[model samples]
Target: MRGSRVLSATFGYLGLTVAALFFLLPLLWIVVTSLKTPEQLFQYPPRWWPEHPTLENYTYLFSKMPFIRYSFNSLKVAGLSTIGSVVSCSLAAYAFARLRFAGRTALFYVLLATLMIPYQVTMIPVFILMRSLGWVDTYYPLIVPWFFGGAFGTFLLRQFFLTIPTELDDAAKIDGCSAFGIYRRIYLPLAGPALTALAIFVFMFQWNDLLTPVIYLSDPDKFTLTLGLAFFKGTVVTRWNLIMAGAVISAVPILIIYLAAQRYFVQGVALTGLKG
Candidate 1:
């Protein structure tokens, strides 16, 4: 029995290692490619390790483009969107989870139903509305909609809130606490993991979003990192090395944020659906 268990564990570890490598190898290649010179990048046999690694691509990327401005723009949009998503979604989730009201379940179901409709369906209409509001070629279109609570964020937080004991709400009420007071004092404080998870999700989404930015933002000054990266592609010759370098830079913040809040992210995901 011990021998069997040992063999099972070994296989499990082997499988996990293989899966990790499968995902990591491409990222490694991107980093390796970013360090290579243009000459080294287009070598005949394609060297895994550059014969001569250099930071020329990164230098060229910074010198030729307003990379810093793009970074700032991305930070602005993602940061504001994350804050908005957390505040709006948490409030909505608190209501759904704790408030007693007519049509609450039906309303929740209706919100979830919207998730089934793909963004592609509403993209054109939303753009038209933005254009009419004179928000085209601006950050408002990118950041403002997120201020309204999203279905996914609301649903995730609601599930997490449901897992918390209702007795706390009752106890808070007995202590002369109002609904908003209970949510602000007890629920929000205890929901650290869920809030962190939601913030990370919103930040990552807004940071990496390409389609929405592409549609709304036309001016180079307002371009996000993803949009800035797109400029590297030319009709005649695309700069793969520069693109890879920009990709590495863009990925750094996401990696840092995820690593920092990894514990909360895992805990939030694990606990969210426990009661639901």
Candidate 2:
């Protein structure tokens, strides 16, 4: 039994190591390629390390592309969207989890059903609406819709809310606190982990979003980082080094946010999953 347990542990470690390498290999390659010279980018068999490392690719990308502008646009849209999503989704989730409204359950289910519908199905109509509203080429299309509740965010927060004891609600009510007061004073404070997780998710989604921005934005100055990065891939030739450099830059914010909120993100996911 002891020998069998040791063998199982050895295999488990080996499998984890292999999986780690599998996931990290692409990231390693991206970093290495970002540091390589243009000539080294096309070398046969590919070198893991750059033969002649250079900062020229990053310099060229910044000088040539409106990367700073793109980064700012992305951050503005993502930051506002995250705030809107949190506020709207939390309100909706709180209602669904605590309040007793007529048709509440049915409405919640209907909202959930919308998640099953493909975004492609709604894309055209949404675009037309945006065009009609004269919001095309504006940040409104990307940031405004987030004010409305999202099904997934609402669901996640609602599940988290449900886990909170009703006794707290009762106690707050006895103190003459209204529904909004209870939500603000009692539950919201305790829901830190879930809110952080949702914020990170919303921020990442908005930051990485390409299709909505592409459809609405025609001007180069308003383009997000994802679109700006595409400038490196022209029809005739592609600047691999520049593209990799841009990709590395684009991934940095996400990495920093994940590292900062990783504990809460994991705990929130686990708590929500377990309760749900």
lDDT, each prediction: 0.88, 0.88
Lowest lDDT 10-residue stretch of candidate 2 = 230-239
List of clashing residue pairs for candidate 2:
none
- Give a tens-digit lDDT track for model 1, residues 141-237: 8989888998888988888898899999889899999999999999999988788888888888899999999998888899999888876565216
- In Å, residue 8's CA in model 1 sits off its true spot by 3.6
For residues 62-141, write the lDDT of model 2, one tens digit per residue: 87767888899999999999999999999999999999989999999999999899989998999999899999999999
The best candidate by TM-score is 2
Model 2 CA deviation exceeding 4 Å by range: 267-276
Which 10 successive residues of model 1 have the least lDDT summed?
230-239
